[model samples]
Target: MSGWLPVAPCTPRDCAGHRGARRGPLPAAVLLVAGSALTLLGVLCVPAVQLLGAAHRDRLIRRWAYTVVRAFGVRVLVTGERAEHSAGELVVANHISWLDIPLVAAVLPGRMLGKREIRGWPVLGPLASLGGTLFIERERLRALPDAVHAVAQALRSGSRVVVFPEGTTRCGRGPGGRFGPAVFQAAIDAGATVRPVRVSYRSTRRGPVGVDGAPTGPCGGPSADHSGHTGAVAFVGDDPLAASLWRVVTAAGLTAEIRLLPLIPADREPGRRALARAAQNAVASDSAKRPAVSVHQ
Candidate 1:
């Protein structure tokens, strides 16, 4: 791997932990089938969806993405105010699971900036290509500038470009990895606004009771509980796609919360490094009190 390519230390054995609370084999099997069917349906409908006007297309994309997440038995709780839809905005979020892709699209449907490898995934590859994903060669240091230029062109052409600036998936237990500055340069190049979104996973099942007999917040760490189900959603180092998919389908009551922070104007930032830092800080700051959870099916 190139020295510039970002790599996360998390692995399935150490960070993913146990399988946690799972649905019965039958129910899990059903969920897996449904999720796969939905994904294939999306792939089939791409041509028809492209024929619709931009406004209508976006609505369908959002609804389809939301249903896909629901089909996998994951509940979504979106907090924080979402910025009004506009052209040339950069949507950046912390990477954890493959679910993050559709999760973000459900709320903010846009052209995704993904690893070049995703272009070869089974059902998702064609859909990503038809949906206008920008693929970058993450392992080649020489490709960095060209990738940034491609993103800049997309933004300049009035497309909302979604990216995972962390460069790779993390375990989502704590602050995972730093946002790379390279992608931020595209925002600066196009004078686009940067929207930092934070993604966190939690098991809906309550943890162990405290000394006072009330359920305590997350057993031993910031997220996940005794079951370790929430952490299992993470697709980290060396975890096969098939295994991760099975884990997601079997896990019970897995909830993904997306926090949308205020937007930062790229022009106002001194440079890409500073912009990356500001966005990272905004995402890392989870100081706000928990709002009433609104489950999006």
Candidate 2:
């Protein structure tokens, strides 16, 4: 990591490895122990989900997510109103960082549609699986149909599903990927309402610090302008998880904002593309209002 990582022992004020602590490994060690305990417990409970029931299990998962967020010392900010707890509702949001997952999980506990790669991570993989995340293999075009059906079935069963239609993470300051139309079909088939959410990250520092290890340059990406803001909160292209995690822990006074806009009712007649465009428009409009954070090249 280009930035300094605090390797010190956990203290009353620095247990979460916030910036400017005497560097050492003890703080990370503390978080690792706690995270491992939670992950193991989640994995062990996977088989008992049927007995515990989805709702109860969801509560547990949400609590776990909430704890994980606190362990990182990042603040979650809320804006606008949340959708009613109705069946077949799809929550679509812009993806900016790995933090977005747990942040959303803490707010709206439910099954998430994640990329297949997440299933292979050491601790996070098992925890996410145990939490009932549906993994989609982005490279396997043939499997997409089944994935859509699975999401629709979950919606039909009244399970709220969260999706990052951007397909990949973006720097919080720039335009996120346009929504893919495939996921919207699930809403059409299951008659689910689409909730478009805009997620953004702000740092305690000023100046455009690059997240991708690139130097500040006017040519491209988040470093395009030396806006004197830190991209430490961003988890964009080619950035390793460890580096991102380190950056997050050391970023003092970082906050993530989740704005849940009015829900869009699913069309009675099937129109996946139309629905996708509408949701995309809603998200893009709100996202544009935030300060532009360019993606690091």
Root-mean-square deviation (CA) per prediction: 4.5, 9.2
lDDT of 1 by residue, 125-235 (tens): 999999999998888888999999999999999999999998888888666688999889999999899998888877755443212112222222422455433665888
Best by lDDT: 1
Error of 1 at 43 (Å): 0.6
Q: Quick one: best TM-score, which candidate?
A: 1
Off by over 4 Å in 2: 1-41, 44-50, 53-55, 206-230, 268-270, 287-297
Give the TM-score (vs. native) of candidate 1: 0.90
Report the C-alpha lDDT of model 2 over 1-297, residue by residue, as the tens digit. 111111111111111122222213566556545655665766776677647766787677667776776676566666667435778789999876788888777767778998788899887798688777999877777788999999999999999999988676656444456688888999988988888888866655434322333443221234222443345556665667776677666555566766777788888335988888888888878443533232210
Residue 1, candidate 2: alpha-carbon lDDT: 14
lDDT of each: 0.81, 0.67
**Poorest 10 consecutive residues of model 2 by lDDT?**
1-10
Residue 139 CA error for candidate 1 (Å)?
A: 1.9
